[model samples]
Target: MRISKWGDSLGVRLPKAIVEELRLKPGDEVEIVAATREKLVLQKADDRMTAFTRMAERRLTMPEDYIFDREEANKR
Candidate 1:
């Protein structure tokens, strides 16, 4: 596969055969598990629980009295 310029980023256009074999569709997320000068490896991204685990590892803290307001968070 060849990488081409995509707006401000580089992108590879996956061949139709690989796309069909992987069952990938537009907007599906992928993770690059490994890369080297000669090789690149990609896998499907983990689900929400993995995201939460990574977030927890960041050790983010908030004020004890803080309360989450769904409406405020959803504001555009």
Candidate 2:
């Protein structure tokens, strides 16, 4: 249990082993909620891969080529 000060707030620096166990990083965000007198819930956001894939599947076309005129212009 590493304890450190964050400016004015007394922050608890999570130990390296615990951080690795939780797959947490410096910039990763977590949700903290009071579950009970002793339990504070911390979790990462749900994976959005399925949602994003569905949205991407709905897309009809993707940008590939624009007019194909570059070669002609180069010839000129």
RMSD per model, one decimal: 5.7, 10.1
- Model 1 bad stretches (over 4 Å): 52-76
Q: Candidate 1: which pairs clash?
A: none
All models: lDDT? 0.81, 0.67
Residues 1-76 of candidate 1 have per-residue lDDT tens digits of 8889989999999889867877789997788899999988877666765766776799765579988788999995
Task: Specify the poorest-scoring 10-residue window by lDDT in model 2.
Answer: 43-52
User: Against the true structure, whose TM-score is highest?
Assistant: 1
Q: Which stretches of candidate 2 lie over 4 Å from their true place?
A: 45-76
The alpha-carbon lDDT assigned to residue 68 of candidate 1 equals: 75
C-alpha lDDT of residue 20 in model 2: 80
Q: How far is candidate 1 from the true structure (C-alpha RMSD, Å)?
A: 5.7
